[model samples]
Target: MATALPAPAALLLWECAARAFGLLYFPPPTSIAARAYHLWFSGPPAHLFLTAEAVEDLLPSLTRLVVGWTLAAALGLATGLALGRLPILAALADPLLHIGRAIPPPALLPLFLATLPIGTPTQLATILAGVIWPILINTADGVRHVHHAYLDTASVFQLGRARRLLYVIVPAAAPKILAGLRLSVSLALIMMVVSELTASTDGLGYRLQNAAGSVDVPAMWAVIVLLGIAGIAANGVFLFVQRRLLRSGQAARPRGHVLAWQQ
Candidate 1:
């Protein structure tokens, strides 16, 4: 309760300032909230109070974000695991990985646009290009640093390769992989908006662009607020899943094994 006061207090101050100054561009919070609700949330009860614009624009952006992020996460985890397990492969790919990560995803958007269709495919590629590096690097680092004792235990049990990877290696490295995933969520959202900002007909970014062009400051603020809410919601969901997975992983391990791994 105490921690939550600051945000509302700050918003109240902002509202007072905007109203006092009669700022056209920076509208009060109340007005912005009203605009946002009308634009995206006001609708028939059958559609869960989602306006047609929200259904058309917001849902597609969210779909792209989820699909693109999932693809990046899968690809990153697989490649990272292989690299972590094989020093030779890691060595060979090290320079390439460094170079690839250094290049910004948006810089390659032109190439993607030229090659792929100006829709989901190109958007996904942009997201994958940007979001994969952190997950890959973090997973590889985590796996590499896993306690050798764990591996020795698996070997003593004569665990097959698949079983060893699934049971021992993945759980051990999950913390790092999850950290990478957390970072990638934000990157995925940014890429989603950027991918839709140009050569696109629909999505939140397109709506934002149109609002700005038309000088609809309140609408722009509404979109910005919606994006903020989306980000917070995404992070909240990830944290919930992270906690559940970590707890389950700990439960599955032998007593004191997690402490030993931490040490």
Candidate 2:
């Protein structure tokens, strides 16, 4: 209750300020919510509550965000695991990875645009580039920090490389990996908006930019609020899943350790 009040309280203050000042630039939260409803949710239930504009703009943004983030997660996990486990590989790749991580994803947008056409691929590439680093680095760090006792137990049991990684290292490192994923998700959302703003006719970012340019303050505020809602919703879903998975992993861990130690 305490946590929830601040947001609503701030919004109420904003409403009062906007109304009292008759501010044309900063529409109140109520106006923004109404604009959002009119733009995206003023539809019959049969249509799944999304206006045509939502189908045209918001859906594409979400699709790109999911696709790009998924690809990054898969590749980052694989690369991170390999690098984490193999000292030789890590040594060879460390410098290159550092260099890559130092450059911002948006900085490479021009190269993406020049190489790929100005479309989904380019945008996905840009987002994937930005979001992959945290997952990769964090996963690698987590795996490296896995208890040596676990590895010794795996060796004593004569567990194959694949089995050891899947059963021991992954489960132990999952908490940190998931933490990285949360960061990656947020970065993915930001990159999605930025990529659209840079080169797209539609999506929330482009609409926000267009609204601002056209002096549609209410519409601009509506887009910003929608972005915030989307971010909070995505994070909520991820954290819920992370909690369940981690709990299940923890439950199974003692059995795994006992079996490994006995062998």
Top candidate (lDDT) = 1
**Model 1, backbone clash pairs (residues 3+ apart or across chains), number:** 0
Count clashing residue pairs per candidate: 0, 0
Clashing pairs in 1: none
What TM-score does each of the candidates earn? 0.95, 0.92
**85-156 per-residue lDDT for model 1 (tens digits):** 999999999999989999989999999999999888888899899999999999999888889878988999
What TM-score would you give candidate 2 relative to the actual structure?
A: 0.92
Lowest-sum lDDT 10-residue window in model 1: 40-49
Give lDDT tens digits, candidate 2, residues 127-160.
Answer: 9999999999999999988877798888999999
Clashing pairs in 2: none
Most TM-score-accurate candidate: 1
